[model samples]
Target: MSTGPNRIMDEFAKLMTDAAGAAQGVRKEMETAFHSQAERWLNSMDLVKREEFEAVREMAIKARDENDALLRRIEALEAKLAEKGA
Candidate 1:
């Protein structure tokens, strides 16, 4: 191969490599900025964390279960009272 063609090809390869490196750097910077902006936006809103939400959900479920049990117990007691009165 002629030196001229080889030199041109090497220069083209180096340019492509440099461009790829620059693109990667830009991509990383964009990702970091996007994440920062997203974090700021999220912080601006009032939101519950997953753990807190799950805790409240569990408390509600437990309260509902207890209420159901109490209701059933009352019904049973009422039935027993009627049987004795009759």
Candidate 2:
């Protein structure tokens, strides 16, 4: 009777250890799946990530500034033309 109880306890302990390992593996798989799905969604939307968006936004801002400067020069030239016409 004593040996029988010891063997049962040993088996239970092994089963518990195996279950724990399986659960950890399942957790890792879930994490990987979620990561893959999110990446797909982001890509499908044609959305730029934060870093890329910031770089493009900076370029746009520079272009807008340059355009404004050009507009001012054009207005100045137009004024000179009007003066010559007068």
Candidate 3:
């Protein structure tokens, strides 16, 4: 009364396919819910995003460069003044 090898394999294949489909559905739902929650939390926080932070950092670097140039100019002016006084 036992089934043949082919029938057993067919049943097993069906079971595996059903399990894979169920897992995919669960993954999609979890991904959607996670994104929704993450967006809400990110919006609630008044934080600068990565892009904005990077831009500000670049600006700071540029400002530092300009400040260094100004310092060099001031030193040169002071040196000239000392020579004139000597």
- Which 10-residue window of candidate 3 scores lowest in summed lDDT? 1-10
Question: Order of all candidates by lDDT, from best down to worst?
Answer: 2, 3, 1
Of the candidates numbered 2 and 3, which has the greater TM-score value? 3
Number of the top candidate by lDDT? 2
Where is model 1 more than 4 Å wrong at Cα?
50-52
Q: Kindly report which residue stretches of model 3 are placed more than 4 angstroms away from their true locations once superposed.
A: 1-9
lDDT of each prediction vs. the true structure? 0.95, 0.96, 0.96
TM-score per candidate: 0.72, 0.62, 0.72
Residue 48 in model 1: shift from native, Å?
Answer: 2.3
lDDT of 1: 0.95
Q: Which lDDT tens digits does candidate 2 get at residues 11-69?
A: 89999999999999999999999999999998999988899989999999999999999
Please, what are the lDDT tens digits per residue for candidate 3 over residues 9-85?
A: 98999999999999999999999999999988988997788999999999999999999999999999999999999
Q: What is the lDDT of residue 51 in candidate 3?
A: 98
Error of 2 at 78 (Å): 1.5
